[model samples]
Target chain A: MKITNVKSYLVEDIVKPFTWQVDRPGSGDGRDPRKNFSCVMVLDTDEGISGYAKGPKGRIMMDLVERRFSSDLIGMNPLNSEKIWEKCWDTDRLEEYPLYAMAMVDIAVWDIKGKKAGLPVYKLLGGYRDEIPAYASTTSYDTLEEYRDVVEASLSAGYPSIKLHLRYRDVKTNAKLCEKVREWVGDDFSLTLDASGLWNYTDSLWFGRVLEELKFEWYEEPMREFELESYKKLCDKLDIPILAAECSDGSHWNAAEFIRRDACDIMRTSTHYKGGFTGGMKVGHVAEAFGMKAEVHGGGHNNLHLCLALPNNTYYEDLVIDVEDIEAKGQGQLKFENGMYSFKEQVAGVGIEYDHDELETISIQKYEKF
Target chain B: MKITNVKSYLVEDIVKPFTWQVDRPGSGDGRDPRKNFSCVMVLDTDEGISGYAKGPKGRIMMDLVERRFSSDLIGMNPLNSEKIWEKCWDTDRLEEYPLYAMAMVDIAVWDIKGKKAGLPVYKLLGGYRDEIPAYASTTSYDTLEEYRDVVEASLSAGYPSIKLHLRYRDVKTNAKLCEKVREWVGDDFSLTLDASGLWNYTDSLWFGRVLEELKFEWYEEPMREFELESYKKLCDKLDIPILAAECSDGSHWNAAEFIRRDACDIMRTSTHYKGGFTGGMKVGHVAEAFGMKAEVHGGGHNNLHLCLALPNNTYYEDLVIDVEDIEAKGQGQLKFENGMYSFKEQVAGVGIEYDHDELETISIQKYEKF
Candidate 1:
């Protein structure tokens, strides 16, 4: 019942090199596909129910838990998720910050809770639906033809929707690309655009109008998340649902300001950024109270289960290269069948099993604290 | 020039037991005289001009540096104060948070800068003033007479001003105590009230009115710092200046929102909370651009020098005990005379020299990472 120890493993190249048809807008600018790494955290408890979670980029988060958070967690009951989350916030007193570290521990604690209860994390959380619709969250691409091909392939593979991480720089060119994707997918398929907070107010407005014309489902992170006045203006001027507050300052309390200001249509909450699942749940509740949908920022089994628990969230953004490619690489990646993703029935907690052999091979460093 | 190793020394009871006439407003309710602990950090560079700082609440922060931050610092240049501060921010991506840990290192970096330049830290920070007026920041008292006596004693001691950390509950009693102190201190003597964020909207309004009637200098932390709407209302309605945004979510950018909302008259920025001297300086600059005064929350030679470097800051709230009491315990405390405190000519960097014997006696934990 007590958290006895916490271990962090830094795994490198766990993910195979996968290229986006379009370059990731405004980052690395023509460099090779940036490699992927995992910081895996395993929480060991006295009662023999170990919890697991993925930490932030390697040694940083692992060191955070061991040095700063371990003492607080060591003697406490693993079920006290709320207290553990609050302790992480109080440790720094920075408005529920150090969220990356908090999430690693919190997700693990939740994993413990699910395991102890003999229920999936989703069932423990309110389990609104057994399955949620999956949308293909596409990476950026170079040409319109590439985007068109990807969308066509995704639709052909039975994905109900696609969300684009569009190109940076030119608003007109990005708008043209969105139009091409919309035309390629046709009217029945849902499409959304994530510009990665690339545009300013005027450009965001210009591009938003284009999405509105094409009946795109939503336009996400069009402007800086903190630009409340601009977000309000964009929300007023545009017809597309604005998904924002993804990387809010600290806790959900910080994100609530966006809702308070009437800034965006859909609120973005995640275990990674908004403290952890505890923080994410609070954000979802806050958005729900305002009659707004709180969208999980990206896809993962953890996020999908959280979506299932919260009635307010509507879709799962299944992130990938191609389903076959991910499955081929094996171990860490989830298997996608026609875009629907779920945890195995026997898999409790976060439910995603680590490929231990692959994890060990890629691991560059490891730290354990009790 | 490169940081070779980082050492954290956890010193216990370095601060002597000094009781306030009353308790601190809302914290440590009814506990015995609180023990003082120091988390001292020493940044050893390859070139041998080392830097030092005191971190947040004992071993917690010291361990943070040893376990998480040392690796990042080992090969880093001590002169890259700005870059070092940013890297700390990037470590968590929590809005330049974990300020407590960052401050401990940054103060040392600034110290290094001052030593390397053979100029005091203030001179490096733009040296707006060689000396700053020190105000007696009083702890809570049990009775109005105790407060009246303390104010009278502080004034008689040649202090220019006194700020009160008033009782936790009962707005009316706190207002009455404020009125009594104001009447006793008479006109032209500055008095500020720190309610310790003990009041809500109505009570804050009620007590703020009393301070206004008495011509108090400022009201500090009347309500929760995050209550932007309440702060805006309080600022608009009250004649006395509202000092707030002390522990904002992410560095000063989070605090800047208070200015953007026109929420408070004076801004609170400190090395401990606003990342470090680097972040504190940024907050000070932001407040300066708005034509508002940014006040350092507490006194320390480190903070005083930071204040001296920033033009917008006006005074230092010398915290906890009388300067004499502070100096009596030894090492890090500054000397105060005739309402002013300044660094000694020989004191370089942060200008604080540890009482090595006292530090050694109190040392309970030590961590070093290279």
Candidate 2:
């Protein structure tokens, strides 16, 4: 079918109040705002079916598209998505042009295409399953007490696993936070640590050893993303799986390389950056081919779209998001059966409704057509 | 300086008979009305001295700003660009929000900060270099004869080095393109290949070894981006310096990891997607710190800003963009002396003058006021 539109939105809120990772210097300090909940997007189609995907923000993505590359996409067929991807990639004159945004345009268009084709987005690329398993990903709690409280809350909510955000700047605070989380969560649960790419290779290695002793399910971005050697080194020497936390990897090419090179085992991805139903399906194909676990990086309205569709998933991460945060609109879209998410019975696109006017209210009025 | 305004424009040229990409096998194949030149942004300011930064587009990035993230940005101190960046990132609540676009908002705000501080954006980031080198990078010509004509023209124009875009789908095309290019350029002159990540590891090794025998300067995206093993396999096994294409990098963090892991010899980056001047500069710093040469991926007027003030760069690739394709007025803001580009001494704040009427004429004119 011919494609009709490529619209971007500045949606404000979903169901969950934007949660944040607050890294305090000491015990009982204020929150850190460097990694706050920010922007997202929604795409609409001519067939009255629309889909939404969350990202860092469309402001940057939109600019590149409307300003430099809109002509790359204008009026064309929607079903022939493969060609569109190639054309965009071909015209990607700038190496630094955000692949994620361009990818989203492809994804949103694909979502619409699936609706038009009367097939689920994942099925378009040959999905093997209808649901995926999920784990619980946590953030920096203020103190050991808070950390323990949150970990218990998440585990009790039915998540079989959990990932703790660990920042080493304040050793004593971090030590206590880790100790409390371990003691509260106990041994049977799958616990992990994400250093958030703050530590150096050595620092991460040393801490990772300790984390392994504590039995972490995986170590997420323990070191910065660029240190492939360190990641490989850690993977080679350590027991934990090195997860690319929230990294903008839409394809499993990197993860495939890791597996091909015998460098890594886990690939962290999300719909906002990588796990859109389409990307998830495509990337999953590669991950499965490699016998590696496709770890879903949490974000946006990550319901059961791609997770359930995946066959090589390690676990679906809750990302420490609250259930109440799933706005009533997105509530039935996916079911959290005993902490594991299952998609709704409805065949709706994305299966989530956003409050259009509410989205408008949150917009900073950056620009409006007069 | 308090931020007072944020403006984004989808500008186009009033004169050119533009062509949007038409072969939409998948996504936007030159969708609707076709024209040239487009841009989107978030213009921030105090009472005086307005600053602009390129922002992300689409539902995800825009949704974040429109939904709730903008409130944190509005009425904030504009001069604290770094602080503002921290704020935008820190306030993120969802697990998977599009980060590239949010990063753009932060970068644009930083641009405002630099402008308000009465300093060039590079200077604000602790201006590391005084001048950056640039090379002439281009696509495959119709034939070796025609290719030589272009190369001869560049040589006469005074470029010390040149690059050839290799789009060979098979070994024959690859060898033909390389053979023609090497033959046309001769042995004394230096040149590189842009494989566009078309080959596999084995193919990469074979192609690289062939290029090395031919004495080609370096091969780019030899075996796909993120194929670290392929890159390392080629680098360690084959002695050629590989240029890391942007498609392989998920973000600066991944690029950093690629470098740390000894991924590429030359860092090929673009200011388009990686968050304008701020993020691009940060990436440049990473490349510099790693002892790799930094090359701006694409060319437009803004690239002139990056190449200037930055030292230790090998080339200003995308050097000769289709200026006719540029959205800004008077594309001659960049003055290249020989192969070297001279920065504007008289210009300030990106030195870009965007025309509102032109934007209206070329743009589909979606929402203007946030």
Candidate 3:
């Protein structure tokens, strides 16, 4: 079906305060984490089927999508998803990373694909599994006791695995904190660490040794993603599966280089940062060919479906500041039971139908032509 | 002064038909060139002083500039050109190709910089020289005779150099045409060739040997820009300086890799294609540091000013289907003198004050909020 219009709306009321170890001082870009808001992108077709996807920090994404993507997307057929994805990528001259707007449009287009087929997007994505284990990716805490308490609480709350978003500035302290969380959870529970690329080679080397001794499951972005030399060196030494490619802008073609180089043990990707379903799947497929696991970063129905579709990905990251905030904002039907999260078989499209009343809580920032 | 707003208007009546060797059948994207339009980008400030820049293909650029750039730019100082440039680049996750809207904003910001300082943008851009040799970069002609006549016409028109945009499908014919144009212009006249990357290594290798034998001035995008191996191999085999990286997305950092790898002998960059004055200058500065030339691609007041500012660039490319089309479309004030083109230094900004009467002839497609 021919697309009629593409519009983006900024919803500010639902902004959730966030802090990550990667966002702390000295983290690259030095951008302290702020309250994250949602920018919902809607693609309307002449056939009367409309698909929408939500992204964090809607303010920035909305502008890029409207300005860069609308004109290219407005008149094309929604079913030509591959061509549309390529058009968006080529329009920006195929940057190293994926455009959030393009990725969101890809999700919206997949939503349209599912709606037309009378199935959920995951099914369209090959439906490898209906469920996967979910890990609690927590925010960085100030004290060692805080890390221990958070780990214990997550275990009590039925999370079998919990990833530590450690204080990156003090690697010694972060290493001690990782040890404390592991001691609290013991060896049976899944423990992972995300340094958020805050460490240099020395710090990463020092902390990676501690994680290796502790037998942590995976270490994500312990050093800068661009520091390929450091990543190669670190991956060589660490027994823990070193995950990367989260910083790979969005092209799987670029991701393929990392795969070829033996850069990391696990590949990190998601729908928001990668180009969309088509792009995300491309990266996933590449990872599969290389005999490596592609960990889908970020949590959403789209991500969950992607994880389900790809046989290589191990877990879906359920990132939360507080588990209660999930219900406070009406994010979606993200059901968590006994350390795993799964979708409730969405009947049509992406299946995230925002509550009308909740949507009314936030002001409709702007809506205009293609 | 704070930027009050950022607005873009699409001037539709002035679309020029262009076909590069890159747009030919089996050459990459395979989309034939159409009548290209211009998008005029204006960055207005609180003090009532405004800066503007023009780019080809207004429909896509207009939407992006208005939607993505306006919000981040509106309340910021126009003098924070570097910061504005980085903000735009980071917002899009820093694509490899220049963000056209960001580059235009950079031009407009520089326009404001010049206006505020009451100097031409070229003067502010180091004012390396007042005059640079002008070359006639022509469209593809059907036959060799048509190409010969155009070279004669351009030479008769007082242009010092001519770059042949040759038919790339047949390397033998293209090589013959290059030799023909060199003979037609004689050994003293500057003769360059742009294949728009229509050749593979075998064709480029075969064609490059011919250009070497003929002693052509420069070979532009003789092969794929991304094929580093092909570029390196070609550059090693050919004596003529291989001009490349015109397709380097938009970041100078990525362009730096090409220089580090010795992929091309000459660098190809432009204002709108390279992320505006700030981003384009960064690439040029890197080229300067590397002891190589940064040849600004495309033609407009923005590129002309950039060429005037840079020490390494040898000529300004004046691309046109017909010389009259340049004046007819009111593109810029490019005065052709004895074998050169130069601007009668305007009072301030980019110095291209569009003829108010000529602007009246085209429709102002859209004007709205940042």
Residues A110-130 of candidate 2 have per-residue lDDT tens digits of 666767777666565555566
TM-score of each: 0.74, 0.69, 0.74
Better of 2 and 3 by lDDT: 3
lDDT of 1 at A130: 75
DockQ values of all predictions = 0.14, 0.20, 0.11
- Each candidate's interface RMSD (Å, one decimal) is 8.5, 8.2, 7.9
Q: If ranked by lDDT, best first, what sequence of candidates would result?
A: 1, 3, 2
lDDT per residue as tens, model 1, B93-208: 32233566778878888888877887788787778888788788887656677666667667766678889886546887777787788778887789888876666899999988
Best by DockQ: 2
lDDT of 3 by residue, B1-370 (tens): 8998766777754235554454232211212234334677777788988887777545546545654566668788988888887677655532222366567778889999999999988888889988888888888877777777677778877777888887557887777788788788888877788887676788888887787777778888866464555677788887889999886553686566577557888887778667887777788988988889999898877888888888988888887575454333223466667656568546587887664346545746755574
TM value for model 1:
0.74
Docking class of 2: incorrect
